[model samples]
Target: MMIIKMDDNQKLGENDHRRLGQELDLFVFSDLVGAGLPLFTPRGTVLRDELLRFSEELQAKYGYQKVFIPHITKDELYKRSGHWDKFGEELFLVKSQETKDQMVLKPMNCPHHIQIYASKPRSYRELPIRYMESTVQYRDEKKGELAGLVRVRAISIDDAHVFCTLDQIEQEFTTIMNMIKEMYRVFDMKFRARLSFRDDSDAYIGDAADWEAAQRTIEEVTKKLDLHYDIAEGDAAFYGPKIDIMVTDSLGREWQCATEQLDFVMPKRFGLAYVDSDGSEKTPVMIHKALLGSFERFLSVYLEHTEGRFPLWLAPEQVRIIALKDDANILKMAKDVVKKAKEMGLRAELDDDNETVAKKILAADQMRV
Candidate 1:
């Protein structure tokens, strides 16, 4: 519901990310590898890694601990998390030949993270345990619905979770909002908030009182932060209400890239608890968040937004030293420059190709080097 102006200088035919991705050689899809699966080339991986590094760096500043989990898990995990019932049709089932176990490619990471939290008993002192991971999740998408990186079977998420007491919910959410704001600011994207709360739908889990409480908390924090947001009824996650960060791209299009959800359901379902000062077990509130919801989707929006003219810090080829002449001294000078740039932690390259200077410059410009 939020509107903003962007650079609409790109012509109609130039804003297609699929075409731009091909022209830039960032990624590819092959029939043999199947559909909805994108293979990131070396150049594309540089872009991916740079974004991930930035995300991790921002989270690390806020005391978010890094965590890793397997790509596949037993089907029971999702069942316990309520995802199996909600998204069972989108699951890719795996049959094990060695045993009678029903396995699945994980559709999400929350359940796996919950297992890690439940591995040990927790105390009030250890409240607000924040865990983060940039990893891939799989889904069985309909072939007809697949398009470029926008809709893919393999999704790379900058996912995180926070387990905290009710008293800490506001502070935790505020910290996450600050992180999201800083990230979008660096990306030069304009965004607004959407308070996604459940309507009178039977699809959502958790008690009515719990849902009301979570939604109230989100609204209170949003107002406290002075964010411009609209109430989006029926857009809530099945288990909780969320603050969906809707980003406006250069083409004046809005994409939901980041989110922070308040869940009083998952922790109770997983039996996650902490010992309070009163010597009683209390359920911790779970916050599911993603700064960049899906790397592929974000890149798709960003590629068109900047027309592949990435910022210097994020450019795969930050510095290109082109040798204008075939002389040994010129080549050595170009190579030395590249070496110096690399030593300074830049992505630099020397283009000492056997071609005309004009042609080399044209190639560099085409590659956005």
Candidate 2:
């Protein structure tokens, strides 16, 4: 395990992304843009795009189709999903001027994704319908709760939903677990499972039989995967039981990074159904997934985890070619090298700045370029 030490900081010091973001010129915050929102620089956006593609690539392997949802939706949708009552003041309501439409910035993507799944009549053959979306969602957070990237009002969420039949629960769950496993393996992240099951609480918004059955399915799948997990009662989302992936960061602090929830509520709430073999109508089960949770928070954790020394594949500035002398011919040759590297799909750049070779080398070394 890598340990990072720093001075004069909050929970994160030298490894703090806020500190590193300034030093590395990755992102910036402005008073005009408000406190919680941040503007990602070209470099920071590279980090974001790279990580987003990585997750999407892995998800594509499981037949998960790309999806898009509006940042704002009609207030009635959340009211139907029960999120309006649950989230209450935490929601960012957008009032209409031209019409009587009361809109709110979406706090979650599952409800919208459910609308897509419920749009058409499905059959048993389309048992496991999967949809993936990497987008932003908004929430009205308290002033005291805001942080740099970890906690903010605007969140870049990598959210997905799987509408599958109850019989196909294990298969779909395993598929989602495999996706999580592959991501953790790629980042060399160690994680344990907290099977967030519901206690006998009224707050849990589903039938008791459905809750117990879903919990059993998760337990069986965990055993099948040979994963070391703990059952956490009352840790479930109001709508369902879930598997939360708790990863150990470089500071030895455990953060809940990913979640795969088994929901029997959302689909039913939206009146989603499919045709069974016997021509009976049935509601499909829902799996709400946040593969890396929030992108900003994940990047913050990853920034600390790697200490900003990103792997060759994950690095924003993979290579920096510097000339030995201030010779046009030498610089031209270096540019050619950079062109070849770029052709080879490497993030490469030529250091043609009016600086000494020694200074260039020192700067690149310090920047992890």
Candidate 3:
């Protein structure tokens, strides 16, 4: 519901992600696969994998352990986490003939991660436990709301969750904020912070006191980090308040790519607890975060931001050696260059097809090689 002015100086017709995606042969849409679901080609897969690897590397440096969860879960799980009540209409329900369990495709990963944290009794020594995952989440998006990759049913999120005590909230938030900053800096994007808070409405979960405490924590951390932010009422998630990172693309358009939320509701709802220093059970606070809100959506913004001219580290094909003519010696030389580049751990390829040099060059330029 929030709006910001977009740059009218740049023409998007040529740099549109959908058009570039087709021209570059990165991904495709098949009618048989259903709407809002994209199939990435080999080159597209390479780009996605490289981005994921970078995110993982950053997470590893911060002591985050990778975790995995199932794509589907029992309906009871969401019901307990309050997602069923909040997003019931958007859930994709499934039935199994062999069992009486009610199942649905998971639309979020927090509840699953909560189960892991609750798997064993925790001591204060393990107060700040961080888990990270890059996985696809399914949502039954309205057909009319679906667009290219920006709004899709299959969304890939680089999600992380931190289960820490109240005292650890500030430091945990600072760590996540630094990661977000580094990521956007690497992409050469400028961003600001939006303090998304809840309004006086029955739509939100948890007590007013809990909500106030969570929002206070978020604001304190924001101020501590000297972040420039504006408070947006009624924009908070049903469970908590969030510091949403609003990235400004090269087109002067703002996109919400990263978020760090402070949650005191979900942990209590799921009865997640850890033993305190006093040997008393205390509910741990949950922080839900996403560095790249959704890979598909991020790629859509970044593709247009750079007009498909990806940096060398992220490009699917880093080097493309072209033979000037059909001479055997020229072809051999081009092959040797490609092999050398590959040996140096670069994504290199040879364009030795029997085609004109001009045509090959044009093709490579179009593909942003």
Candidate 4:
């Protein structure tokens, strides 16, 4: 274990392991591999799997159809979605080795999700189609700005896209809002909502009438849910307005976790449409919702918020079974206990060797394991 002196003054009771990331060995960022990119050690991977399980349960309950898309997409895709023009600065673009075409590592998953929606001709019966995916996304962040998992080159966003009709937009949005609230409740987090809207003068795509209708619908949903939110002008996506949920951490810091965005632009740009009940084809309103903004940023926020003392359920080492002595019998018993814990679906570890029990316990405790 590596230990660094935190202060020149007294050492009494101070969490020596807040530096514990280095000492207890959860994750690491190396200069050689570049900044903001993290290597999740074995311990960290275990914690990540638990997060995935939680997301899976939510997906199943909410009727989200899971789909996977390529990491690298043609430049034309983002260009069509307006992301290429507006968000090009943060996107990582690459040219093909064999062909002259350019591609980009998707910063967000919505464009690809739009493609899926446009893949099939739909009727009003399939108005609300929710799709979910947990995948790695890449971004080109400034080197100086990158720190740990909070600001990183690559991130996994807990992304979902709900494509629905104009009438169904409000109901679907409300459901998403409630789900976001419930998700934060699971983490025992206190959050505030931000209503992000566009400026009238902005040259955003879509009609003024549609924009006004979308904004009004968002307001109605917020009022219906009795959710108190702050309005941030000019925070809206080029396509539509959004409701962003900001969670306060243990250190009294706020981080934006979930967001619900209404888009009428992308559908039209991608030529996405569905047959109405009257058999007339119309563009479907798309709601982009992410319960966990981005895994890298979430971990970064969570680490500091919890100060690395992850909840027992999310802790990488839920239990550590250490032998009292290095005797053969004790080692055998420890192995059995570890096996049983694994069978019970608990993340358990056995530390048996020449190391003293006190030292092992301290190590696990420092890891907040």
lDDT by residue (1-369, candidate 4, tens digit) is 334564484242233323545555777877799777888888877666677668767866878889999999999999888888887899998899889799899988999998888887998998799999888888899987875566788887878899898788878887887788778888888998899888866657778888888888888889888988888888888889999998998867788878889998888888999999899998888988888878767766776667678888898778889899978998899999999999998988888767888898887787676
lDDT agreement with native, every candidate: 0.93, 0.88, 0.92, 0.82
- What does candidate 3 score in Cα RMSD to the true structure? 4.2
Q: Which lDDT value does model 2 have at 336?
A: 95
Better of 1 and 4 by TM-score: 1
Q: How far is candidate 4 from the true structure (C-alpha RMSD, Å)?
A: 3.4
TM-score of every candidate relative to the true structure: 0.95, 0.94, 0.95, 0.92
lDDT of 1 by residue, 1-369 (tens): 222322253233556888788889999998899999999999999999999999999999999999999998888899999999999999999988888799999999999999999999999999889999999999999998987899999999999999999999999999999999999999999999999999997989999999999999999999999999999999999999999999999989999999999999999899999999999999999999999999999999999999899999899889889899899998898899999999999999999999998999999999998
Candidate 2, 1-369: lDDT as tens digits: 232443344444676777788778888888888878889998899998988888888888889899998888899999999999889799998888978799999999999998888778899998788899999988888977888888888899778998888888899888888889889998989999999988876777868898888899999999999998999998999998999999988779888889999999888888999999999998888898878999988988888888788888888899999888888899789999999999999999888888888899999987888
Model 2 lDDT vs. the true structure?
0.88
Task: Give the Å error, residue 18, model 4.
Answer: 8.4
State candidate 4's TM-score: 0.92
Which residue pairs does candidate 2 place in steric collision?
Answer: none
Off by over 4 Å in 2: 1-12
Query: Candidate 1: where are CA atoms >4 Å away?
Result: 1-12
